[model samples]
Target: MSLPDFDTFRAAQAARGFDEVVARSWAPDEDVATHSHPFDADALVIAGEMWLTVDGVTRHLRPGDRFAIAAGTPHEERYGADGATYWVGRAEPG
Candidate 1:
């Protein structure tokens, strides 16, 4: 699903009570092996590009692009040539 701009995304997350938010930066061509989160997550790309593979579907995400990760869903990622930076919002545990 498509996502709104950064400000809107942040606001929505706040409204949903996502108290844990962080900004992360990846190095050029950085790769992350498959992993899963214990809680739901929302990631918004702020700079450069990211290639994300989730449930065997790969998506190329650029600035202003966003994606969601359900709890315990396996995913992997690769950064673009120029690297990337993004904001991640995590839902509070129930």
Candidate 2:
């Protein structure tokens, strides 16, 4: 689904208690092999595109697109032809 602007996304994440927030960028055709995070997180694409695969399913994400991943869920990511930049927010465990 589409996401709000970067500032709004960050504010929402903060409001939701996401303690770790950062901006990340990927180069053209960059690929991240299967991996998992220790904490649940959400990402909001700010520029270019990304192809994200979670549990073997892939979806295209463009600017303003957002996605969430649960802790420990295996996933892979590939940047678009022109690469991408996004903001990620990690939630603290209760």
TM-score, predicted candidate 2 vs. hidden true structure? 0.88
RMSD of candidate 2 to true structure, Å: 2.1
Q: Estimate the lDDT of model 1.
A: 0.87
- Across residues 9-86, which tens digit of lDDT does each residue of candidate 2 receive? 788899998988888999999999999989889888889999999877899999878899988889999998999999
lDDT of 2: 0.89
Tell me the TM-score of each prediction against the true structure. 0.85, 0.88
Candidate 1 C-alpha lDDT tens digits along 1-94: 4656667767878888887777889999999999998988888888999999997999999988888888888999999999999998998567
* Candidate 2 Cα deviation (angstroms), residue 18: 0.4
Which candidate has the highest TM-score of all?
2
The alpha-carbon deviation from the true structure for residue 10 of candidate 1, after best TM-score superposition, in angstroms, is 3.9
